[model samples]
Target: MAQAGEQAVGIDFGTSTSLLAVGSGVGPVDIAPLGRTTRSFPSIAGYQQGNLLVGEAAENLPIAQVIRSVKRAITDCSETMEISDEHGTRRVDVDEVIVALLAEIGTRAKAAGRPLDTREQVRLGCPAMWDGAQRQRLLDHAQNAGLPVAHSTLIDEPIAAGVAWVRHRYLQYGEQVEGRLLVFDMGGGTLDIAVLDVVGGPHPEISVLSALGVQLAGDRLDTAIAGEITEELAGQGIRLDGLPEAKTVEALVLREARTAKIQLTTQARHRIVFRGLARTQLPILTYTREQLEECFRPQMDQAIGLVWAALRAAKLTELGGHAPDKLRGMNGDRLAADIDYVLLAGGMSRVPYVERRIGELFPNAMIYDAAGVAADELIVAGLADPVGYDRLNLHRPGFDFVLEYTESGRKITEKIYPAYTPFYSPEEAWTNSYLGFERRGDDFPGPKRGEGVLRVRSTSGDYLALRYDGETKHGLRLQLGWNMLFKIYCDGQILITDGARQTRKLRVHQWPVVRGNGHAELVLQRVDDAPPVPSTAWYLEKEYAPPGL
Candidate 1:
């Protein structure tokens, strides 16, 4: 529960479950639980009879009608899926399902006593690998769902987890831990890994060095283990047949396998007994922790491969002064000697085998066991600012600003913010264009305002348009004619004459706009009667201001 004044709510809408956390500007972040289940809520929605239900209330619905893992569905860029129920079959877009789920969460949160009335104060977490279009679609859906998220921004899943990890350490130790960290987040449906550099202080600073994600996780593990159970049952007298019957049996096996997976964390073996699956009796089944580990071995190997790949990409594997011959069979302990902590987040981290493998890899570093960050409330905690949390000082942007126009009667596209440029604050100054690998030196100009000029030359055409392939806040158009020269200054203040001199409310694009690529393109051509008012111009320059001002 949150104390009254201007509460900042952070929602971890997971694939299998969701959680909400609330905090004021300068206090400890509190977990807002759903009913009596502490902080966890089933990330499921169902339509039964004439009523729609979500979270725990919707968990027991028929599989055909229940929408689960809608986050992953939307991330796949899917449009819709047809589901039949008492209301008949109809197509529902992934976005619509996500909206419904979020709306339900909103209602539940309010009823639970954490008011998220201010849109700007809410932070939502998204997958790390999502592109610009996906991020925008989510925002659009959230808005349409009637979520007041005026100041809402998307956070990378792993980054959010890292933020929580650091905060917990700070509160417990009263000392800021400074060093690099490798965040491994293995949830029910997805695994996201990111390397972040943490700087502890009264105001902590976290920088994401690199990240990677995979679609396979606990769901796949559960299926693989369930397959083994079904094979054993098929060997006996009882066996499931037909689509409907098989699905029912499959669902039951999955549920049991999931339970076994959790039980294997503590006990040596777990029994999988099903009596009425598909209306058939089954012999009691038992699986040991070793067998369950075997089921997840392949996925664990994949997770290892991803971790190695990320470390290699981040250059952590480079033994600067060591001999080349010694690098032959380098393991994680040697490769990540500089990393102070290996933090684990997500429910799957609770598995003893999973922890053992991660421990083997980071033998030299203290691995944060993720008991404190299991629900991923850290992302919103990181967004909280006792000083100025709502301001765009935190949170990474997920889009690349692309400058596109026509040249020689052919369209050309240029990537302004190259992918290699590390995540930076919106107010950070730009030096040497921050050209990713093309950077000449290691000097990074600190936080300061920056400006760039776009020279529009009318070589042979009179039509030019500026476009960004990602979501935009607002667009601005200005024209400089011979008689009345339209002068745009480095400062964001615009001096436009509609009829009188007045400054209209302007919305620059989303936060942390890449400063090096901060310029707009347009065409300079004479029109027959260009209006002197703000409208009717050749083209305009669009800029992104720091959000939540």
Candidate 2:
């Protein structure tokens, strides 16, 4: 719920462009005009005349002075950008640039008659592959830019796009839509895919089955097209390699390639011209849809592969397995058949070739292109929607908890909690009994009168060492469980209900400034300064093993 005189705000802080929308908690969300005639503000900024400029104003600066795709740089762990201009080179913090751009967005929103209030609820969108660290970074930046938002207010970009699609269909048909939906969001920096199950009624319920993302999208395509143009120029003996402003020329070529790419979405061909380079004017070139398709095919194939991977992950979730190949009778065709609708979103989704390829892949599923509603507006609209905003059930982190130990002179990794497990739902809390520490041979006495370490690992390479100190004659039976509050506990017993047992829960002591593959980093401090002895005697009992053991 929003406060009085407050409008809900949704900010899609995208890689290439950022958009803002505001609603009065009653009517449809209105896309705020960032500029006089543009709804989107370029995700770029620069310093001109010793003052910071953002969006279109920054676009007017020299390519070397301007920083483009700041969102992508943030995701890639970039901390600073060097802007070289007539005033000389100066190092600028990436966070400062992001905050400046966001502040400008807020300024424009106010000018559009939708003044952003700190009491109003604000939702920000991030790529699906971004882990907790990245999400928190964005939240901090937003708050620094005077936006009222928290970590809980951050939503996955693809999930927000899905909500937008669901809302659009519900409004268009005047009926609630229910089915399995696959949202493909190919933005400038990343391609995010989400498979969701929607239950339509007076109160809609949306559940995300699986979600995945890759760092391949419109920017990569732009780079590919630019590379092709460079090669063509090289073949024509028009070499810019030894030129004084090679970097400037390269930047100009990339900008033109991006413009051509956007124009080719509507027209079959686009004419690109590179001007204002360091004393040399490159010839105008004609870029056709076919040529664009050629540049996009390989990346599209990779994106399609990621879609299949996401589908397989979803199927694994439905089938209650740790791996896709371990599930019986599972294939691509079955996965494709299970999808009821495919929602294309993001700026890259506007490409006709991308739409056609998706249609061909999922022939049976109904395809909803973003052309009907502008791609840039989808996330913000969904964020501001009161109905969908309240009912949306965003998917939790998709990461597997694994236990690694040495058994019989070989290293073994056992998945304790499979990916997509509903750890946040009390009714869906899962328990695994596959963890055990026993006396294997004379070499291993099962932590007899000494402490041993049980290494707990995550799919994202985060790990924790659980120390077990006790004297067990027979063995130690370990049970791992995840509660509704996103907490994981490991209870170790001496094979007797009333016997000596140690229960340890790994909780985040402090938020670590580390990044991972969409997985929360498990940070825990050692109880003692002593070195932990690796528990090589631990093994998983076959009787209690889950599928894909």
Candidate 3:
């Protein structure tokens, strides 16, 4: 159990930077690496023969030995990476390196006064395409590190992102929401879109329409710009791609270049010093925005094309020709083509051109009204909030996710969490409701008693009421924090089971009462001798109430 004020944080491990946030009301409140401008440690890790170095300290090692882009290796299983420092080179498994990074993050979490890993509450975001094996390996690695990892879930980056966008715009610090919406998550590695039908008649129907995992992102555009610089430098009779030494110098020069590339989109032109390995003073490289856009224009178009694909899927979701129609969420009616709104997320979303391109392609939709951020950060924030999904559902057109598998070494398609049921509840925090993936009905396994996944994201001193799909069962509450005598209850069974922050002298309703109706009553249960909050909640469709409620 976690402290009452604690948050089940969401971690976004990106190629360039990684971040963590707790609950929605307060914030991700950046956890800085020691002695920096409150910036996160670079994902880069450096190994000096025997010792290990992570973040800025690791930069001391030669660039080659300092593994900077660990995100690239998450998908591949049979990959072996080697880094060398003058004296010798060593080999490390990619997953091991990833774990090392996570261990450092755990350290960061402890420093922040919120140790999610130690507390066993955290939702991890992964590329949408990460498979069972990939997810399993990453989860194993996380568990190995003292990540508290009590309940670690693999959320697709895009979906996590979509969830975030929803929070940014709709969820008020102290409130409950109801509705349908859309989430667009474009990040350093991929672009994802979801149309959520949040759960409940008004608040829980968070069904995902589709999650499109794009292979291209900021890195691709950066590479295109780098390629152009190389070509231009080569034409200047400066061979940046010729000799190995020359390539090294060129790589280093471009090191400070992409930041400039991103800057160029907003700034007219950025200055650059291209060095020459052959002629000590001759290979200096310089650049301008015109040259960048000329080279990266194709990649930019590709990104726009991908966004179009997402919009098309969203259209299908609204129309219900898709599997979601079977869910019959949208009043048994199809939505209009012109969507209500479109929200943006991820670091790349900050790129001036990205919004422009998105606007051009998806003129029918308006960008989320929330403050903009790196494409990935939005999702990180959303994940921190319990009501993140609810906000989007209430504010936007709607979102959805399409599940897929591969056969004969090829990708297969399936619509598991259709857009019609976006906010559907899960069994345990460890379970995913894509029944086929992690759960099943009574037909296959044990009698399918209600396995409810009631997740509520929030910040400190904040209270929430969640009604799941069952009758009032016994009440259950697990509090790692204060022990309040009276908490909130719903249907007179489950108790809110946490903080007395809002318990008023006048407002008796403010007491932690489990609020709402569902198939299973959401109750905080005292399975054992635990008090304050029970270990869990059970909503009973039949007859279920607390011992004395």
Poorest 10 consecutive residues by lDDT, candidate 1: 438-447
Q: What shift in Å separates residue 242 of candidate 2 from its native position after superposition?
A: 1.2
The positional error of residue 500 in candidate 2, measured at the CA in angstroms, is: 5.2
Ten contiguous residues minimizing lDDT sum, candidate 3: 504-513
Clashes of each: 6, 0, 96
Q: Estimate each model's TM-score.
A: 0.69, 0.74, 0.63
Model 2, CA-based lDDT: 0.66
Better of 1 and 2 by TM-score: 2
Question: What residue pairs are clashing in model 1?
Answer: 119-148, 119-149, 119-150, 120-151, 164-378, 509-544
User: Candidate 1's residue-wise lDDT over 1-549, tens digit each?
Assistant: 122355566777788877777756345677777644667777777678866677776766665566667787766788876655556666666666788788877877888887677643677777676655666677777778766553234567787777666666766566688888898888877888888778764456676655767786777788898888887887875566643456556667777888899898889988888645445456789899989888888889989877875564344212111222233246666667867789877778888877888788887889876524443445445444232222222223233333344445665543333322333211221222111111101221111122111222121112223332233223232221222112221111112221122122222122231212332332122121223334322232212321111
Candidate 2, residues 1-549, lDDT tens digits: the string is: 233234667888888888888755444567877765678878888888878888888878998788888887657988987778767777888998898888888888788876777666677888888766676677778888987776556777888887777766655555588889998999999999999888654345677766788789999999999998898788777887777787688778888889989999999988888888758767778889999999899999989888876776565444223432342235667779989999888989889998999998888999986523587577777776555645454444334444444556665665544433333221112223322222222322232232233344433455533333422222224332221111222111112111123333222222221123343333343222234333321321232422111
Candidate 3 matches the true fold with a TM-score of 0.63
Model 3: per-residue Cα lDDT over 1-549, one tens digit each? 122344557777777677877763434424323224444556778777567778777866665577766766765454657766665656766776788888888787677666664343477777655554565666777878766442124466666665555444443342223344456566666655565544332132345544555557666776777667667667887675565565355555556466667677577777666433444444555567677667666767776555444443444333212232222233211343345556667777776666676666544555662433455466666556554433222211112122223345665333222221222221221142111111112212211222212232211112233333233422122221243222112111222322322211111111121112221222233322223333233431112223232
Q: Best TM-score goes to which candidate?
A: 2
The pairs that clash in candidate 2 are: none
